[model samples]
Target: MSKIRITKEFSFEMAHALRNYDGPCRNIHGHSYKLFVTIIGEPKQDDADPKNGMLMDFGALKKLVNTEIVDKYDHSVVVYKNDERLPEMQKLFENIIIEAKQPTCENLVSDFASTINTRLPDNLSVFSIKLYETATSYAEWYASDNPTE
Candidate 1:
């Protein structure tokens, strides 16, 4: 079986702080983030049609991430752990959701990748998530099956 991999990029704005950091990162700040999501898997076996043999539909994948993840954080503030301001912010807008843990680029990528992997079909594997906090800085988290190694 032949395997296929696809990557998609999306961008959104969010605010967060580095928890327990003594440096400048400890201060609240925001970034216009860019995300790259990579999915990989063997082509489906039953579909004789060229298009049908694809591991997954790009449009559907885009829709899934856009609806479930991207839309939730776009233009929103992502805080580290819990802060007293969270409830106040939630009242002002419907966008705030408490993260299970500290909010950092690494955790954000991991969380989003894990959530997406769980929602996808078993045949499709979410290989990696790269989140760019700035044009020069980014973080990447990979699953065990990632071909990039």
Candidate 2:
């Protein structure tokens, strides 16, 4: 069977701040984020299978991404885990994500890719991810650009 690529789009609200940057983004800010995930795989070949002719069910993908990314990050404030302000921020905000890396769009997209890659069914693989921090700006990650060893 020929390989096929399927994509799904998701949106969420999130806030973040760069710890030591010398720009407006250094302060806490938020964006209505848009995320697109693409998966590549061969459709199920068994005609008797309910999922036959499908690479993967859209609902399954939605549940996976929602559980791993969307549901957790939506309406949440994300900051570097080691940010000095973390202690104070935790006290003030109930929904905070202490990420290991800076919560920039670039890093977030890469993190999303890693998450999907690890959790996807064995027959499917993440092909790419594009994350939009603004209507006019976005970052993308492609599996082809970072082949696993």
Candidate 3:
């Protein structure tokens, strides 16, 4: 009857350029992005259940995170739809992805969280998502932080 949360750390490399920004960041650049994905669930009550007493198996969590986020975006360039470089970059990269909004650290984390939410099992809920753009700069989203939105 009690809720438990589990988090796993994952890192991937990605390049992105902000749209309409008059700064060095407007140019394409890459970062070794670190992500922490957390999920919440209640321990299974049935002792005979395969996942009894655990929120989720670690292997299951790893597989979900890798397939949903890491494998898709790692080593790919993320460009905003309106970015001027989108056209030129598309022709250059062997792999690239376009986002509807500027791919800032905050936006990237939000995207991960939203996509991760859809991939989770019905019994689990996303508790929080944290993304670190650099050693010091990062963003986080917590389900409890927002209400009546």
Candidate 4:
């Protein structure tokens, strides 16, 4: 039993903040967020050909992220809490449904990882998600059996 992992990078710009934060981050700010989605699994038997034994197809992965995730946040202002604009987000959600705990990159990464994991083929499992809010700032989340305290 062998496992292979594949990652795809994506980016989108949006505005958000830590609601009620006592720090500067409390103010709404925008970031050109970068996302790294990792998928792991054993090779597909149907694609046993030497060149394409992996469970994932790069093109399919791209399509899943692009259509299901990136395209939704392209130029939207992401809010931590519900707002009047939620109706609009609701519309988009109808199609792609990318929602988060809060609009922060960390939360975004967690939400994305969970959502993608649910959408992936049964054999493919999501391992981790890394989100970069800026060149120097980022966060990571993984599927863990033990929750962090």
Candidate 5:
């Protein structure tokens, strides 16, 4: 059987601030985040299998991404763990994510890859992830780019 790539797109609302940055993005702002998750694997070829000829069920992929990323990050505010306002922000916001790295789109893609990779089944691998922070702006992470890690 030939390898196939399956992609699922997810969207969520999230706010984040870039700590110690001089740009306007330093202030807390929100984006209708768009996440594209691609999985690479060979389709199940066994005739007896219910999922025969399918690399993975789209519904299963939806559930996996929703549970792991969308459900948690939706309507949440993310900040660097070392941000001085973290303590105060935590008190004011019900959903806060204090990440070790600044919540830039680039970093977020890497973070998401780590998360999805660990949770994916052994036979399926994350081929790439594209996070769109805006209608025209986005960041992409490809497994082929970081062969050493």
Candidate 6:
């Protein structure tokens, strides 16, 4: 059977800053972020299976993304654990999301992909991720496009 691809899109608001940026991005700011995740799998072969028609239920995908990413990042300040401002930011805000590295769009999309990939069910595989930091700006990551590995 041919592989079927399904994509789920999620939107959330988050604040982040560059660790040592020389310009305005050094200060914390928020973006209405958009995230798209693509998953691929082969459709069920047995016509008797109730789920035979779908790659994965949209509701199931939503629940997974909500628990893994949205609930963790929404309306939070995203800072690297080692960031100098983490303590100050935590003191000022009740919700903070920590990452291992600076929170740039490129880095974020990659992290998003990794997080989702790790939690996905064994039958599904992550194919790509497209994350938008702004209306006109976005970053994309594809599992198959990594040539460095």
Q: Best-fitting candidate, measured by lDDT?
A: 2
lDDT of each model, Cα atoms only?
A: 0.80, 0.94, 0.87, 0.73, 0.93, 0.88
Give the alpha carbon lDDT tens digit for every residue of 61-135 in model 5.
899889989998999999999899888898889999989998999999998988898888899989999999999
How do the predictions measure up, each by TM-score? Answer: 0.83, 0.97, 0.94, 0.78, 0.97, 0.93
Better of 4 and 6 by TM-score: 6
What lDDT does candidate 6 reach at residue 137? 95
lDDT of each residue in 29-122, candidate 3, tens digit only: 9999899999998977787898878888888888999998999999999998888778899889978888898899988887788888888889
Model 6, C-alpha of 11: deviation from truth (Å): 0.5
Clashes (backbone N, CA, C under 3 Å), per candidate, total 0, 0, 0, 0, 0, 0
Per-candidate Cα RMSD to the true structure, in Å, reads 3.3, 0.9, 1.4, 4.7, 0.9, 1.6
What would the per-residue lDDT of candidate 6 be over residues 11-113, giving only the tens digit for each residue? 9999998888899989999999999989989876778988777888888889998998899999998887788878888889988888888889999888888
User: Candidate 5 has which clashing residue pairs, if any?
Assistant: none
* Candidate 1 C-alpha lDDT tens digits along 1-149: 77788998999888776657778876667899999999989876676676667777788889988987889988776765456566666676555557768887878888889889878898887888899999999989888744443
Query: Comparing candidate 2 with candidate 3, which one achieves the higher TM-score?
Result: 2
Overlapping backbone residue pairs in candidate 2 total 0
Candidate 4 versus the native: TM-score?
A: 0.78
lDDT of 2 at 42: 95
Clashing pairs in 4: none
The CA-based lDDT of model 2 is what? Answer: 0.94
Candidate 4 residue lDDT tens string, 4-100:
8888898887666565667987655678888888888887766557546767888889899888778887766666554445566556544323344
